[model samples]
Target: MLRVCSVFLLAISPLLSLPTGMQNVEGEVSAPILNEDGSLLIKSGHKSSADWESFSIAPGEHVIFEQASVNSSFLNRVIGNEGSELLGRLSSNGSIFLINPNGILIGPSAEI
Candidate 1:
């Protein structure tokens, strides 16, 4: 009985260690750009330690990237996954910049 149980556990352990890919994807930061031919270019950045940064979103995807320091003032709200309109507010000490009219750059002492 013990040998049978050990064999079964060993057989299932490899499956338990399977890579689902989401874990690797989670830590990646992506920037999307438009090519002259109208194709999409996605550049991935590694997750940073400071957490106060922004990147261009992939075209046609409903998503938002936010930083904790400026969450309340800069990125006040994000549109839902359903594709609703978005509204944002910022503090006097901070600024927001729209990069290429697509990406939003938010910072404490930056400009839009």
Candidate 2:
């Protein structure tokens, strides 16, 4: 199952939708861009974090992290009523902490 999912992601990683309702509630996070090409690119500075009303991604969509260094860490806290539906890619040089109290569905095509 895992192997199949991996193949699926590789086949479809360019189509997209991104996480919405994001706000920098605290820390040094900045300049999140959702490009027309369908990727969400976020630059994470040292000790940066953000909050989302909901956090999710669709197949082929990506949540990419750009940081000063690989040791940089960022937090994404979901405050919405619904659980996160992560069915896409989260490519990061650093660590990403996705916190959703409701629940998180990391789908078959997900690559984190």
Candidate 3:
């Protein structure tokens, strides 16, 4: 009887291990060097050059949005400016805002 019960339980074990139709998302990128104050050290590109860094993202099964282009207009404003860095955050409405340390908008502005 024990042998028969063991066989019955084994037959149902596969059902318990089935996936629930959930999938995972994962990707990787090169980590950047952060300053002592936790700011990223960005390397700007020259004219007619492409600039990029490898990035990793994990959005689980949900869709993840990638930025096609960083707002160079904002970065350009800081070309000769010192001690400026770009900071980004997601808004409650799902919009991305890049800000400077002083809480000023840092994207597409003539001044950084």
lDDT of 2 by residue, 15-35 (tens): 225777789866677667987
lDDT of 3 by residue, 1-112 (tens): 9999999978854332211222111222123334464333333222212122211111111111222234322111111222222223211112232222322322331221
Tell me how many residue pairs clash in candidate 1. Answer: 1
| TM-score against native, each model | 0.22, 0.80, 0.19
Q: Ranking under TM-score, best-scoring first?
A: 2, 1, 3
For residues 1-112, could you state the per-residue lDDT of candidate 1 as single tens digits? 9999999988854332211111112333344344465433332323312121222222222223332334222222222122211222222222222222333343343222
Reference-based lDDT, each prediction: 0.29, 0.82, 0.26
* Candidate 3 residue pairs that clash: 29-54, 29-55
Q: Count residue pairs with overlapping backbones in model 3.
A: 2
Query: Which has the higher TM-score value, candidate number 1 or candidate number 2?
Result: 2
Output the number of the TM-score-best candidate: 2
Q: Quick one: ranking by lDDT, best first? A: 2, 1, 3
Report residue 35 deviation for candidate 3 (angstroms): 0.8
What RMSD value applies to candidate 1? 17.8
Deviation (Å) of 67 in candidate 2: 1.4
* Candidate topping lDDT: 2
- Provide the lowest-lDDT 10-residue window in model 3: 54-63
